[model samples]
Target: MNRKIYISLAILCVLVLSLQAACFARTPDKLPNVKILATGGTIAGSGATNTTTVGYTAAVTPVDALINNVPELKKIANVSGEQISQIASENMTNEVWLKLAKQVNTLLSQDDVDGIVITHGTDTLEETAYFLNLVVKSEKPVVVVGSMRPPTAMSADGMLNLYRATILAGSREAAGKGVLVMLNDTIHAGRDVTKTITDRVDTFRAPEIGPLGFFTGDKPVFYRAPLRKHTVFTEFDISQLTDLPRVDIVYHYANNTGDVIKALTQAGVKGIVHAGTGNGSIGKVEYPAVEAAQEKGVVIVRSARVGNGIVARNGEANDDKYNFVAGDNLNPQKARILLMLALTKTSNPEDIQRMFWEY
Candidate 1:
């Protein structure tokens, strides 16, 4: 009887060890599949010298080189790369935005693709991120990352940013939170983040709302999520769109004649974003040209030049009186993105106003 009991215990232990081994063997298969879509940016840039951080040629490095340089990414997720565009973000066009958004939708719809990371230039990075935030149809994580320093720089940040972005893209916790802008180990909501500094690694910040989370080593830690409607909840769709409507931004300054706005109107722009001085305030001289533009059936939106604070409707300007839409907290560039998209759905100022409030 004693021998039989010992034999049974040994068999049970063996069974447990086999089960553990099987689980370990399947670990790689269970890892999330993250797709890296590379758009040219400083992250993929190459400098003349290791110490030369600025004046580097961007989009010179191919997507495959970026992935192969960071081998640690393979341990975290099943990683793959596809080059979407090879242009700097400053040169990022509406055409590229449309193509990128379509590709993102297609990839995320697949069962095998779990999440996506986009490498973009910091200049207009927020614009592209915000554009994706409104149009991407998935609840899966989408992270936009860029670097201030080129990859050839001594303290190149692209590899680490890429690694962190991939981790966030694969993280289940990042789903449904909206598109994220990851840089300097900090995670920001695409809708709220903007480039504050011209040449700093920590340039991106969501001034009013702050960051959604941080990458604590390989793990993503969250503090709060954006309350705004985004991603799957947004009404904008770009699947069938070949191009976005023409939109222009007019800056407000002292003693300014709205000649730029008049020119934009004459140029037949579909919409115009007014970067008002304060509180979305229009100057006395500039108001008439703005009114003239609106009279021509041009949709006008008032956004603050001041980075922080909301551009409330009927506060400094009578949005109701002019049938204009307030930009809410969105800056001029982002406001233009929303307006271009909003025009696709409706031309009515009231309808666009509601979109601003919600999205």
Candidate 2:
């Protein structure tokens, strides 16, 4: 009949190229790619009334409309979005934390970048996730999401917290496990996550250490493993760090006369943290204006406003005769982001108190 119709069209082109090589050898393996930079907080907030979640209008939606309203985050990573900033995470800045830590260490020194989420704004999202858990030298997966409502409110929890922060940034067991902070489904440990309830969507929490795990249905179930010493064992190298040393915190209270620690050490502020009262003591009329701003060289540190624990390096705060450096469980705004990257590498208060007890 025409050579039997060319052998039935060559056996239907070999079963359509063997079913397109087994559908390209099973498509599911190509997932982990994650990028999502965005920095508008309240998960790119905006509210005119979806039942308004507290006078909204922060970071007013962008990063591709917050990843196109999270279309289930394309079945978990291979995602991409950039938008760097829109504001209102309390106007977070150290120049946007050195432009989001040099664009997250230049997209994690790419080789097809396998992780990084960051959508910040839960009011300084744990101080930019503990300053990218001490300058991300990339152990891979660096999450840091946010959302205390305001993605247009009404049960709006930023699209399931940006789909569980893109499945914990394409988890490979969230590699190395340092800078993470996913929201309600919990995962914290951007050096001890904070933000305890103000607008509530489970307002993050890691006090006394309570989360390095959670997200049951979507997997990622860790169980305590952040022994500090983060990312490629960090030494705080912001790759030629542009500028970041004016640290300041000061909050003691109860007739506190630390005059904002001699007015932030006469507004030159090399370092200051304070935030004392209980374990981080300091308000006996604010220790002689923090002992004259540490005899003018200015390194202080203390930290406590009693929100959780650890401020203990030396009991009643003599801290080795006033060279002061306690802030252990961090929290005076992450002890001013580790005293501004440990005064950019050592001003020596016992080597910045062993870099605040090993980061």
Residue-wise C-alpha lDDT for candidate 2, range 46-129, written one tens digit per residue: 889899888888888888878888787887767888988888888888878888888988999998988989888898888888
Cα lDDT of candidate 2 equals 0.84
Measured by TM-score, how close is model 1 to the native structure? 0.93
**Which ranges in model 1 have alpha carbons more than 4 Å from their true place?**
1-26
- Report, for every candidate in turn, its global Cα lDDT versus the true structure: 0.93, 0.84
Q: Backbone clash tally for model 2? A: 0
- Candidate 1: C-alpha lDDT: 0.93
Best model per lDDT:
1
Write model 1 residue lDDT over 28-132, tens digit each, in one string: 788899999999999999999999887889889999999999999888899999999999888999999999999999999999999999999999999999999
Q: Estimate each model's TM-score.
A: 0.93, 0.35
* Least accurate 10 contiguous residues by lDDT in model 2: 23-32
Please report how far candidate 2 places residue 6 from its true position, in Å: 34
Which residue ranges in model 2 land beyond 4 Å of their true spot?
Answer: 1-26, 33-51, 55-69, 76-121, 135-138, 152-157, 160-230, 235-249, 252-272, 275-299, 302-332, 336-348, 353-359
